[model samples]
Target: MAKTIFITGASRGFGRIWAEAFLERGDQVVVTSRKGSGLSELVEKYGSAVLPLELDITNRAACFSALEKAKSHFGRVDVVINNAAMGVVGMVEELGEQESRDIIEANLFGTLWITQAALPILRAQGSGHILQLSSALGVYTFPSVGIYSASKFAVEGFSEALSLETKDMGIHVTIVEPNGFSTDFTASTIQSKPLPAYDQVRTALYSNPAMTESDTYGDPKATAAAILKLVDATNPPLRLFLGKKALPLAKAVYQQRLASWEEWNTVAIEAHGL
Candidate 1:
C-alpha cells in the first residue's frame, strides 16, 4: 500500500530528507518549495512519483490552490506535512515589526492555511494525518529565541486543539517537536538587529550548555526513519518528539511547571469560589 504524502518546504533539511525516504520506499509525494530549489532533483530521481510545486505557504490563496492541485494530481493526500516555516532569532524586545510579522506569518499562519486547505480533502476521504513541524522551544523557551519560540508555541496550541477536534473525523494531527538538530535551521534563522542593552542577557543564554546542545545535535536523517514508523502506525500520538534531547528537556520543563502550578493552586481554587 503506497501513501500519497504532500509536504511543504521540501527544498531542504528535514523536508528533503523525508521526501527522499518516501520516494525510496515507493510512496508518491507532492513536495513544495518556496523558491523551487529542491523539487527538480526529486522529480529527476523519482519521475512522476514526485509532484513538485512552487509554493509560498504564507499566501493563503496559493496554499488552497496548491492543496487542490495535489488532490487533483494524486486523487488523495494521505499525509499533509505543514513543515514550511521560518524562524526569527530575536529577544522579544529586540524584535521589530517586520521581524515579528515575518516569523508569525510564515510559521503560524502558513501552518494554519495549509492545515485548513488539507482538512476538507481529509474529511471527504474520512482518513488522513497532519504532521505539524514544531520545536522543543514550543514546550519551553530560550531568551534569544523568544520570537521563534513564540511562533512554535502558537503552533503547539492550535495543533493540540485541532487533534481533539478532528479525532472523530478520522483526521489525526501530530505536532512534531524536534530538539536542536544539526540542520541549517539554526543557521538559517533570520537574525533581528542586536540590542546592546541585552548583550549580557544574550551572552548568558548562548553560553548555556543546553543552548548549544549538551549533547551533539541530532542527525537529521534519523527523523525520516522515525516518521516512516509514525505514519505507518495505526494509533499515532498527538505529540511526537524527535531527537534525543526533547524528552529530557520536556520532562524537566513539565516538572517545574507542575511544581509552580501546584504551588499556585490555592489562589486558583479560591478564585473559582468553589
Candidate 2:
C-alpha cells in the first residue's frame, strides 16, 4: 500500500531528502516549507504526486489549514513528519529574550501545534505515524547551543508522552535524534547571540571547521531510509537515533545518568522504603 506522507520543512536538509526518498518509493508526499518557491520546484519535478504547501508551522491557523488541505488532496495522511526546526547557537543568557522565544515557538510549539492539528485526521483513519526531527542534544546538554538544546529537549519529552498517549489509539510517534549530519545545517544554522566571554569555549566545542567546510557526516539519504523503515514497520520504536555519532553519544549519556542514579540509589531507595 502506497502511503501519503505530509512533511514540513521539506525545502532542504533531511526533510527534502526524506520527501524525495518517499517519492522514489512511489509514495505520495505533501512537501511544505515557509517559502513557496522551494516547494514549487519539488512539485515541478514530482508533479501532482508532490503537493507543496507554503507554510510557517509557527502559525496555528496555517498548521491546521495545511492538514485540511492535505486531507482534501490525499483523502488520508498516513504519516506526518514534523521536521521544521530552527537551530540557535549561543548561550541562553547571551541570546535575546525574543530570539529564544522564537526558537521555542518554531521548534517546540510549532511541532506541538502540527501534531495536535493532525490528530483528528489520524484518529479518523484510526492509524497513522508521527515522526519528530529532534537532535542528539535533546538527550544530553552541551554549551554554546543551549537555546537549540532546550527546544529539542522539550520535543523529546513531548514525543515521549505523546507516544504513550497515542500508542493505544493506533497513532505511532517516533523521535529522530540525528547527530552532525552532512547537511546545510551548520552553514544555515543561526546564532542568537555571540558572547565574548564564551568565545574560547565556543571555538573549542561548537566550532567544527571540518563540518562547516566538508560533508563528512552521515548521509541524509541514509537517514531518510531509516525513516522509511520506521514508517513502514508494523511495530516501530518510539525513538529512532540517526547518524553514526548520535547513538554512541546518547548511550554514553544514558549510562552516565544511570550510574549517577545508581550511586545514589541506596539513599533514594531507603527514603522511599525500598
Best by lDDT: 1
**118-206 per-residue lDDT for model 2 (tens digits):** 99999988999999989888888787788899899999998999988988889999988887777887644677657788788877774
lDDT by residue (tens digit), candidate 1, 1-274: 9999999999899999999999999999999989888589889989999999999999999999999999999999999999888878778888899879888999999999999999999999999999999998898987888888889999999999999999999999899999888887764578889989999998898788766754658889989999999999899999999988889878998999999999999999999986
Candidate 2: deviation at residue 19, Å?
A: 0.8
Q: What overall lDDT goes with each candidate model?
A: 0.91, 0.87
Clashing pairs in 1: none
Question: Per-candidate RMSD vs. true structure?
Answer: 1.3, 2.4
Alpha-carbon deviation at 241 in model 1, angstroms = 0.4
Which 10 successive residues of model 2 have the least lDDT summed?
206-215
CA lDDT, candidate 2, residue 201 = 80
